[model samples]
Target: MNFFKTTYTSKLVFTALVIFSSSCSDDYLEEMTYGEISPSEMTSPGNVDRAIIAAYSLLNGQYDASSSAFNSPASNWSFGDVVSDDAYKGGGGTGDQNNIHLMEIFNTNPTIIDIERKWVALYEGVKRTNEAMRLLQNSQEYDVALKENRMGELYFLRGHYYFELKKIYNTIPYIDETAATVNDYAVSHTQYTSEQLWDKIEENFSNAYERLPNDQEEVGRPNKMTAKAYLAKTYIFQGQWQNALDAANEVINSNKYSLLPNFRDVFLPENDNSSEIIFAVQHSVLDGAPDNYNGSIGDRLSAPGGPFYSQYGFHRPSQNLVNAYKTNAIGMPVLDNKNLAEADFVDPRLDHTVGRPGIPYLDLGVLYEASWARDLSTYGPFAPKKRIVSANSPYQIKTWPYISALNYYIIRYADLLLWKAEALVELGDLEGARAVVNQVRGRAKDSQYVMNLEGTTPAASYRIETYNTPWTDQATAREAVRTERRLELALEGHRFFDLVRWGVAAETINAYLEVEKTRRTHLTNANFIEGTHNYFPVPQKYLDYLASTK
Candidate 1:
């Protein structure tokens, strides 16, 4: 028998038979299968709910720790931040998490442990989601609409998993309920073209949007708008401008979500499930959270290590990224400020995003110093801040101070606004696009900057202004939207992908490395070759696994 069949059948027979003779037969109970129940026996609504939760559990991408650096983290900080111009591999040195270091310099290969670990972790999510889907499909206990909704969620999760893989590796295997075992997961990544893969992902989101309810009582559950935003994102990535615009318009016009009053509040623990958040991976600090799977492990690895917290300083921001925040006296970006040491006027969002020297770090009242960095010389003086939780927040996991239950947003409304602006710009609506971009900038304009201990004065020369005049042309609007995304969403793990999709990764990153080399000597070897470095090499173990089976 097949493994699932054999295991399940054995369980059924074991529970049905009794060891005692006919005298004891009268006392024998026709009890339910209490242990090792097969999929057939696991048909109750309660059991199906458990399986659905199991599918959602992998959203945080936590598995029992085996390796550190390349372990599959859902956050994609290493790929999105560390390898991009936004950050450095901020740990000890090149020898530390050497796999990531190689990636930092564009020297990645299939043999790297991070490659293998990331591949395995994401595929594990796929496997779990697929298993849950298979079980749900076989279950008859759920009502029709309820089953469709649950199945839609599985589709979204699967699409998200495949989307990550597609972005990073370009070509990847697509698996679902049809493929249920280890051998089934061994399909080749070359089976589908890149466009074909994106189509498959889009199909999932479309199904999710159609089947999911407009509003869910549970805050964490994805609704129709959630899937629509993701669908818009997928279309945006593919330059399906008209499709992206329509999808974005649907979410925006529905008025289901809006930007938070303060941009900083979006990241805080107390303000979770705010109007801004469309879909976020819900984490919990409550005890017995299944090996802490519900907590964000990425924060622990990237947070301040020595003096600040018992963590590894892995995702430090680069000086180049810090300098990108520089604004002119007019409150517009000082696009060509090569000679300026300190910006005469800087964007307020900068202080919120990066922990610079002498600035007060959050509500801790501690002025951030250069010593906070694990290696100031290698990674530069700045530390990451946007995702860092304040020590005073009650939502922090008590036992694991470093591991936080803070939700990581998969899609937020602000992103929707910006992406809609991008679509408009692409469609020759420069003036129309300017209004949308200015809306985002206006939010940053009103938001408070970092303050002193007494909350009296701003930390840096904080100043930002929205574009008062219409964007003259498409090029200008495009640049404005891109810059706004960099400043507004910096270090929240979307940089590299943005750069790559824009077809400027080589030009932008290569330029960043050159400037970065002068500031920190470690990046002297870093260069972005156009084709080879755009997507990471497929994991070698996959090739080996397929070869062995062949």
Candidate 2:
């Protein structure tokens, strides 16, 4: 949510600035920083742009935690396999946030700090945008058409921030205008019923869609399609299926963006900023403008262990998730009761989704033996891709050396396609859904992941089998899509909330725990009561600050 903001006071300063500063869209964060005016000399535009960057910089999301060079959610954490009692670090921060932690429905670990930071960061982002909105609403700068064109991006940012907000924290305190100081920071939060909040969120995104351009020469900023894409997501979650379909179709029809031929380019640094990226956190390591590859998710997932290296493999593949990958003797996917001998390196998706057992991890052969099983010996059936590196970098100066530095991809066309397919399923359009689903499946074989490297057994041509999602009925389709999402978006910090929104916590999870008995070793089943488990207690610290009366 707050992609990358830091410190409360910093948040307060930047956030205050965001709400009051006046900035144009592209220049929103790029105000004249060098050799600028004094306090009395500085005007609105100058204040707004810097403030906008401050919001993006601190939104708990500057970089992808999963895909980063070194994972930072504490090595002993149950980072990826969250939502199961199977993973916990015996410490308390905000897990009590609403039984969201106790139930394993939410990753109570502060890595979910993105949730908090994004809330503040987006509000800050909104502050900057609202300032611009307020300015352009009556400014003498540009003509009305030019003003609205600029306002399009500002509105998109505000709406996008709110949409981002409601997804995590349910009913949030709504702020329609800018906030500049302590007095502006209301002691009490404004309340909106969930429906009403979504209404405001929808209105902003709708205005954004109408105002934002269909295409931008640059890659990151919001476009008409960008606004629509998120609105479609918001609408689907709100259960406004028809509107969801229409919003998605608006982007699909725009012809400004298209799926890249190879799914891999979507993650490449060079390939980003393309027409396909409707919206992205425009990260630039160039000229040190603060495009942080430093704390990203991709780097963590791919990094071998070192000083800056955070060993988060402490989160393992649940036997349930592993078995879910298992296919019968027939070459297809299935969910059922099975024995280990029958599972002879079968379901290739298990490798695709996780670096466990049969997947390739650069220098490491296969994953499980290399990392989890504690078998340093040239291991058994599968060698775990030990991301924890014992290899010493000769000229090491920085934190971790053997770490891979791929940036985190928050929204990609692949996910959008899946979202579209999932929404179509809910709206009773299976055939339409299948079209998008198969496109992904067809390309799964080409995944960079090499499947059957352990060459003792029989090998036909089942090498790059990605997580499969066979089409089914609405209920089953939703399950398939969710499963696919967990697999596809695994470790990129997604599944916990999916379980909540789908309302599948008690059933899908306990059922898994019943079979995967190992998880019980880390969890307390009673902690996860049903109803309250879906939310985090609105940070108690936040409430304590409010006045007694109003």
Candidate 3:
């Protein structure tokens, strides 16, 4: 069965099981309910399978356990994109989801709802993964080989959850299946240093890489290469260039993944699990859920307001990002804060990535107008186009919130290539890094350009070229790789984290605000402080919860 495509029946069953199991106490009389199953009785292979599916379910970041859907979206649109120079919190007004607006301006506090809810959602993922592992470990009848593979999946998943927590919060408490009691789960965030935490997270991926098979029968399950890619990404974040390069090369030489022929096809629902995708949070609609929570529910607010889309327009593209796509006469990127006018030659990916005014938005018959944006005067006239599903696609759910079944990619092949490129740049392999960057840019250069209505003309002055000359300078090569990342993976929610990891979040964002404040009045007070804004504050409630345990 397609584990991710299943209904929410397993989730409900698993939740009830967790509640029932946790409620048992020694103070109660020893009595057995006739119709109910005890925790021990529930430790079967089938239930373990259901629990694992429940763990997989949380990858979409739509847990009903705690948190509003948008507060902890799987896409990290607010935390990763809006908080950076990439996007703005676009909606009816500043008052609408003002918490995100606070985040956009880098004024976040420990008690912000988004911060707390996201922590809860990610921890919930860890809890579910550990619960599955706990069940599997206690089982007596599961096949040995299958059990090993399933454990590998759990390790990979737990690593992913912790990885998200680490990147967002920096130093978080690490818990595992060994933490059986309530007290065990109440460990402090300060128990491990930041570097140690990365090591802990890396250990999970290493275990996964060791145990997982090279290929899986299921569509969404990660294989050995997936774990290796994550391991490489982990090393990149830690500045372990040699280790990162080694792991990245392992995945690269595997010949298992490749970029899609057309860049635009990568995000389409039909290509959700294509070879380009290393791992994605699988989503489906019309799966017997009345609310359609199984779809891209967290990103529902991002639908560009128009005739066919939901009116709650959020995650609008920034003018800074739009300008970053501009190219010079030879199709090279115009770097170092150069603003490009509307008529400037731009990379073709911009049309596919951002819904600019007068551009055709996907399969919609009409050209994307300025009015397609909600609160255009405040957020800007641009809307996000990459994550959105076409109106005519079967994946689109025509309802109050236009949630789609498009998968949110956790790691795409292009992202891995960029990671390897970053490592090579750091290791002083400038020529090698240049070649890897070209592999990504080359795809854009050769891919089909975005076409206009009636397929009669080019959407804009599309121009993109790969690096042809040898990179003699390391700094230039590094900057070139970083810029290419923005162009290739702009609105997919990696921009802020990337800047932070590169130690340029403060300088980059403050500079962005200086220029952006002039264009958009909302950013007049926005400032990014280096020491304070490097990572989000650990949620105060969690700290309070830990103190109460003490």
Candidate 4:
């Protein structure tokens, strides 16, 4: 189950040395002691490779101590899903992880520790990558090819972390390898606009694309195609339509990846490195480590909330999200708010993505029940299914029963397809956009629908179809692309960012709250202010840390 396939034997020794070096007095310089390697000692090829592995390890966002539930979670369910209309903050009550509850209702402030922890953890990733780059430059044993590959990894990882920060906080301080001390954080977040930050992100990915090889020896290591996908994604985010289209076309023409035959298999541990995944936070269990920290920690809190699973039930699916899967008579998405039960057709992905009552949940052999929910009065009956560990999966780490070693996709082939579709729509190539969207829809139609215990009947009225008509206007094409993104990427944690990119978060969330309040009364006071709530405040501690430098 170990995706890295090998452990960094020198990682612990390197970390200890770094810690020891940091605390030593400048006047009384410390020498490299027994079993310790100094920065100079890292010039060897073996040590430098280990340092790169260490950088890769940080991608999981584990080992954070700020909070058990919210500190640097890789899944992003709380921030991305709950903040949007896709999910609810489900737990014992609103009092449990109250900061997240406040976030869910748009009441969290700049001083909250949860966001601070996320900020810190992501910067920690940046630091690790920078350290690797610094070490690579100093390394004497690596050849030109090796050094370029290492640099490619560093740039891609740094870009990935900064992208996370950019989506979370629209304005953030950008730090690079030049930062020699903590004082560098004193730079103001207002130094650059959101668009400028996007440019910085693009720069990193473009460099990565240039240097990274077409493929990697290791499964999880990003390749040239991976960087191209991220570059395309960044262009889409910045509204650079032609640039996005070009990058997307490059990826498509590469023919290096494709959508999986079945949608559900994309998330299963057995299919960890399937062709659909572009980049993922590689996870492993029982890798002879002290703890299962490398397992999917963000989803540990999201395991079903009953005696069967016995884990905290966070990120419960919203009724609105379930309704989004409903299809009309022609098998297109129901644009109207009709009774879900009366809908003659539904997208098969609904069953794949959510666990509602009476459905055979995974291969667990138990039909889902309302009793599985932690709080029926607040969070509805549906449980998040896409990311949770299946009981039967061998990759499930029993020591940490809630954790799964399944690779969480950061970018997937389907996402690239959608981005391309969006670009085509913006470029007034409606037919081209339809072609791309239909590719995704056709895959969905051909993929597996949910099945019952007897295995002879469909779980629900499953019938999803691609667009039958042609040549739609930009508005309709844009709407279709947005809706498809919602359903396709639902609980994987891109909903909130998608809404923000479309400049419709406030309008969509407010309307969602108005309707959802009538059903789940806990949302009665929910609101999404247009300007302020669009992005989380820059944590006050970051500002304080910056101010102290003066």
Candidate 5:
């Protein structure tokens, strides 16, 4: 989640006395109500709009970072690609390999901050929505559906936040209503077990699906399609295959979104988003906002800000990922053994997976300088990924608050296809899975890899064009889909969770754990078995707080 993606209420810093000066004396620490505007005064039309804006901020920024980072460790990507195991902030420092997060994850890892802030901000949104719903429910100021839609969005968002929260923490103090004091947070937010949370999540998503206006294609908020898609995803996570299939089918049949003609443009800021993106973090440098830090969180992840510029590598693609990029005996990216012609038949998805040295970072900052980022020329050797924008580019070239854009896809149409394929596999309908994976395969052509005709100019030197192999059998088809997903969505917060949800994390991570045990250098002796550390230990402090309070 990019913080600078939108304007927000100024920080409300109260004196230290306020935190510890508990008393009935209201004058001790003057309530610093969010940059001067009190919650009470925000009932006016303009302020309501601002409240809505803040709500949008909550959904995009805080909500996403927490959900993505710790809900699943980045080790999957870092380790999958063999980039950096230590990238896992809590991924134990390999006794042999000095993990960087130990030193880097300080008081400001967005993962931690986002989790805390998302919880509070989401409740703030609930308060505003509750107020708006109450006011509009009784007045003739606006259309009922308009108010209903707004409230419904608020409900869906709360439900979504809870879903994310529950995924991370089993028993949280669920706060559905507006909170007035810290004590109001006493009751457990989640009134049920994971099973109940799933049930409630489905209900809220259903409510959102029914009420969100399909008519408005707003830049930030989730629409009917996304609501359904998200519900479908929740179902996927919970292992509710048929339910997942049902919602996915609804999204596909809706015909509301389609794949962009070109793939890479999907991430381009100028593009806002691909036709396939059902919901995205609305961000623009020109969105009438000043330079913000959240907007540049990835500054250290891309060029100019990364190896291209900095002393530290913000992101590291791993060996599994590099291995995933290798060509096979049949001149393809995947096979029993990739020892074929040593051709470029490697999965075209490689560029999208890991960075090498040749691929171009598509100058995503078209919203700012058209090409402040450059990787296309390939003063070239191996292919380099464009996931991080300012990693190589220097801070001087960027800015303390550089102007970048963020339109993170909370859910996209492509995911629906993936869901459908997964449903097919689970349903024992592998052919259906093949159909879905093949479509995604076709698009990688222009985005990352290009293929050449047999007798074409560059000859065999570099003329080998990307061949979308239309696989025949179901077994091969199932493998194709799995491999495609592993490669395609490599890092966008899916790997670890996917492996866990698929009931494979134990097998996979255990293998890596064993591998690390051997190195015994910097990353040696580190151990992650099937259970212990995979799931959080219910934050001991939270338990301690509960025990004493109870």
Candidate 6:
């Protein structure tokens, strides 16, 4: 349980040396000590454990090495949500975090700080995992099965890091343990095709699935089902529908996870490691760090300004997202491009996921007013709610930038279910996909709905029901599943990636901007070009580094 408590400063120093040596002359590199420990010294089991912990530490995507906390957030809030239709960059103004603003408006370039910082953070994760794997491979004193299990965890971590890199940059150099020299580390991004990069990512998860245990004693460590879940996700991203469906079925058949009874409870600190979570970036407060950096530091800017919360409000939900929650008289989504009117019945999950005007903000004893939003005119009136811990909760830190020990789920059971549903739809199992989607909807329908200020009545005319009718058409079923993903996982840092994977980022985001620009003037000139904007440009620094080597 104390797996995350250890610090891996020496490992980080070693990683820095490896990258630094890549630029040094042969004589200078030969004189330098590349690592804190020699290969013989790393043979200790304790050293290997520390190395593994070091790899896991990068999951939050924040370190002393990073330039800004928000630039490299573990949750992908900036790249995934803000860049998509789910959210807007809600800070001081349009100029505040202008780099992110550039991203939100689809005016991104390789020089943007967020692009570089995120690349660095994810690659740092890759380095830590590689270092851990190296140590584990060299170690002789560790238990055989335990060593394999630890290796499995390391592979899973690396797979996750590379997956993020692949989705964000589209092309990246793949470095593994065999890469000992500068040239090996500087392998060209174009060396592998897109399909090959996915294959590499899938190999890691497959290794993990083969080696990991069914259950892990440590809470944060991934298990067999977790690997399988990720494999399913990876396969879906590759459009390998059969492979994805098979992997998903393996996890779903295990019945190891289910939806939490209450939709809102999933994000609570107390339920950080709940059964609904497949894997999450585990956060801790007051874990002896100078600041609460080990907490949700990446999401610190997302706190809504109010009587009970910090003032640096960012990651405001979009009005489009709010409107997407509107349900018809039959308690199903409206599935149109209309604005949300006061009397429109909405899915109850809306209140749990977003903070709208007049709704009680998570039992804070006060209604969420427009004043809680930092920049209402630029980002609209909504505030992010799902990931924010209750102000009264013990998990929240009483500090300047109020962070909380709320774990950000990388993959939740509901997300996995949706992936399964998506795969089913692609595989032409419309009924199967409907049943899975309904399983998710049934939980939302049965869960406790958000209440009014007095806690006496339902907050809005909340109504959501599963599809009672059969899904007959593939196109309709596909849209239904995709829409379900948007509503169920809104503002959770998966929107943009989902759109890109679905090959609708250009169409969807352009259409979103066409209407959203009218509502928020900042997006007046925003555009999403198909080929150029599919992935962020490779970081200028990385390209420069590659150039220097040449």
Q: Which candidate leads the pack in lDDT? A: 3
Tell me each candidate's TM-score.
Answer: 0.91, 0.72, 0.95, 0.93, 0.74, 0.95
Q: Write the per-residue lDDT of candidate 6 for residues 219-273, one digit (tens) a residue.
A: 8899999999999999999999999889988998999898998898899988888
Which is superior by lDDT, 3 or 5?
A: 3
- Per-residue lDDT of candidate 4, residues 167-278 (tens digit): 8988888877776554554578899987789889989998999999998987889999999999998888888999999999999899988999898889899888888888
Residue 83: error of model 3 in Å?
A: 0.5
- Provide the global lDDT of candidate 1 against the true structure: 0.76
Give lDDT per model, in order: 0.76, 0.48, 0.86, 0.80, 0.49, 0.85
**Clashing pairs counted in every model:** 0, 56, 0, 0, 53, 0
Off by over 4 Å in 6: 5-12, 20-39, 65-67
Candidate 3 Cα errors over 4 Å, as ranges: 7-9, 12-36, 65-67, 336-339
Superposed by TM-score, candidate 1 places the C-alpha of residue 496 at a distance from the truth, in angstroms, of 0.7
CA deviation > 4 Å runs, candidate 4: 1-36, 63-70, 342-344
Worst 10-residue lDDT window, candidate 1: 1-10
Tens digits of per-residue lDDT for model 3, 470-538: 999989999999999999999898999999999999999988999999888888788898889989999
Could you arrange the candidates by TM-score from highest to lowest? 6, 3, 4, 1, 5, 2
Better of 2 and 6 by TM-score: 6
Could you tell me the lDDT of residue 506 within candidate 1?
97
What's the CA error at residue 432 for candidate 4, in Å?
1.0
Judge candidate 2 against the unseen true structure and give its global Cα lDDT, from 0 to 1.
0.48
Ten-residue stretch with the least lDDT total in model 6? 25-34
Ranking by lDDT: 3, 6, 4, 1, 5, 2
